[model samples]
Target: MEEEITFTVPIRPDMELEVTRVASSVAEAMRLGKDKIDEIKLALIEACLNAFEHSKSKEKKVHIKIKMTDDRLEIIVRDYGVGFDPSKVKEPKIEEKLKSPRKRGWGLKIMRSLMDSVVINSHKGGTKIIMTKRR
Candidate 1:
């Protein structure tokens, strides 16, 4: 059997931990492995952070939807802001980061590295990211 959940919240930095907790609870209810749960938490945080940081709308909000099944978990994070091309985002080189010591970028890379699949849809209106993890 599969279950679905959806919710929306403000795109504030302080809400990041709260969003991670909600994702963790759902993953725990689904009896996901500890490592998998950890991955979900991390990915959710990255996704939420990206939405909060990138969104340009005055409302500053994000919508999150989660679906769970016996062998898979899917999460969607959406932001109603000015969107950009995901392809334009280059993967950060570890050596370059160490040399420049910058604190921007890397969220998409981390989300992709942790999830089984990550699909991004972005345009001038908004951005939506669909990520899935398989057990």
Candidate 2:
């Protein structure tokens, strides 16, 4: 059986921690390992932050949906803001990032590295980031 929960909140900085905490609790309830739970928390925060920083949605909100099963967890982060091509975004160089620290581009890379699967769909209308992890 699969269970799902959905929530939407304005793109505010304070909401980031709240969303992360709730998602972490859901992962815990599904009996995912501790390390996996940590990864989920980080990914969720990054996704939300990206929406707030990049998405110029008129509503200024992000929608988060989490689906849980016995063996896996899937999360979708959606934004109504103007979307840009994910392919156009270049991967950050580790060496360059080390020399000068800036905070805008690392979220996607970190999420991909931590999750089992990361799929990004973006068009002029909106962007949806789908991430999944398995036990």
Candidate 3:
């Protein structure tokens, strides 16, 4: 069953729930389990938070697109923000990260862990995080 969904919403925090709903609807359509659903929701929320924090002050919305099939799930989280280099992201050792007093770089790490693949493409136009989870 191959299917796709795409839509955009405001970058404001108020639109967070809308992102979650979009994810949940996709999960249900795919018959995903609770844990898998939660992972998807978390990934979306993290991406949305990033967009809300970093996107252009003049931008009106963030784009989210998802594709699902029997063998895998794919999601694209896009923001019209000043893009950053994903290559510069480095993960702290598990122990160090776990023991650190403050949160940092955890979002990128979490997204990587929960999904089998994550590719971030960012430029002046926008930042798009493409992620996949093999079922």
Rank by lDDT (best first) = 2, 1, 3
Which residue runs of candidate 1 sit more than 4 Å off their true CA positions? Answer: none
- When 1 and 3 are scored with lDDT, the better candidate is 1
User: Roughly what TM-score does model 3 have, to 2 decimal places?
Assistant: 0.84
Tens digits of per-residue lDDT for model 3 on 8-95? 8886656877888888888877788888888888877777777777767367688888898898889888987787777776765778
Residue 73 of model 3, lDDT score: 83
TM-score list, all predictions: 0.94, 0.93, 0.84
Q: What TM-score would candidate 1 get against the native?
A: 0.94
How badly does each model clash, as a count of residue pairs? 0, 1, 0
Q: Write the per-residue lDDT of candidate 1 for residues 55-111, one digit (tens) a residue.
A: 786778899899998889899999889998998987898888888868579999999
TM-score of 2: 0.93
lDDT of candidate model 3 versus the reference = 0.80
The lDDT per prediction is 0.88, 0.89, 0.80
Better TM-score candidate (1, 3): 1
Q: Any runs in candidate 2 off by more than 4 Å, and if so which?
A: 99-103
